[model samples]
Target: KREGDKWILNGQKKWIGNATFADILIIWARNEADNEVKGFIVKKDNPGFAVEKMKDKMALRIVQNGIITLTNCEVEEADRLQNANSFKDTAKVLQMTRAGVAWQAVGCARGAYENALDYTRTRKQFGKPIASFQLIQNHLVEMLSNLTAMQTLCFRLSQLQDQGLLKDEHASLAKVFCSLRTRDVVSKAREVMGGNGILLEYNVARFVADAEAIYSYEGTKEINTLIVGRAITGFSAFV
Candidate 1:
């Protein structure tokens, strides 16, 4: 039931990207009337809404993330999303975003690989370019191997999406696999950079930390693994 023709929203959302500048935010909240999850298009200038920019981010400095709070925020019934009746609808949104995150992992690894390769070519050690070192070449090869595998896997993943054959388990499998391998590639890229690896100016450090966030967000490794496990075993392991 609408309270005097205005719906009141009260909740907190963390790590909301572009919340400060977004003109319309698709907010997912629990409906007070039916206890089901609902979606709302809340404008940035809504009176009862407040946003705080999240600070102290070591990675993904380019992404504008915020902490949003809704306190009796009023919205018209017409603004509510009609299709979102439960968490299943929310899962639909996350499934799409999770696939995008997998692609992002690929791009991020590619960027780090390119940067580290350039650095190794230019940075000299022991009267020779660091790229000529056998250990450095080995690291580069390993990174390339992981990157190539992740790329091929995500390519098939998108093909599945285009064919409408993607399932939760498929997305979870891709997310888990790509995120895990991206972490490995970024780590190796950093390792090959010597002391400059951790510096943000070197750029690999950002990928390294951002990979951690990508790994955990949307779904953690444990959660994604369980989703795939449940699909294969036909038993829900998530308690």
Candidate 2:
């Protein structure tokens, strides 16, 4: 929205997954009068809005994403999300999604480890299966260690969530920790596969690329760390 209590939305949102087919989308916009963030439910048939499908994504290719444009989009005051008064309420949604992202990381890492392990069992080096080698075994063990730790931590995180004690800082911490460790595990999994590591047919390569998206999305490590830092230090580091 612009000035003078008039609504005039003109912007584009990229990588908006499912926007092309979504019946209703919650669009976040700044109020013209107060410049405050507000949300409106935009229906699929809205004339002023258009969504273009984003194509040729290397990672997370199965997830259909779209670039949305809102041109002179109009919504009544009653259509605005009343509860989303500020960025704080928006954070509540992110906190919940962050926890889910942590679980997704675990799944991604576990899939890579399993695939790499299966490959190692049949891949031979020095006249012996690669899985029998001390170096390969060490790598597998390290991957398992990190994966186990992430699983346990996320289990505890879900407990906090179930108990209604989950906070933004807590979710951010899990998101940061799991995503970072998942990156390490997936990279090692790819490394152990030798030249086949980079091949999408081997499967570990996809996990490696997907990990990059998971690490940056929801919240980057720096942002999540600052969230936890502010919780403990009582100082807002976010500018």
Instruction: Give per-residue lDDT, candidate 2, residue 227.
Output: 99
Tens-digit lDDT string for candidate 2 (67-116): 99998876656667879877778889899999999999999999999999
Stretches off by above 4 angstroms in model 1 are none
For candidate 2, the per-residue lDDT at 11 reads: 82
Worst 10 residues of 1 by lDDT: 1-10
lDDT of each: 0.89, 0.89
Alpha-carbon runs more than 4 Å astray in model 2: 2-8
Root-mean-square deviation of candidate 1? 1.5
Kindly report which residue pairs in candidate 2 clash with one another.
none
lDDT of candidate 1 over 85-144, digit per residue (tens): 898998888888888888989998998899999999999988989999999999999999
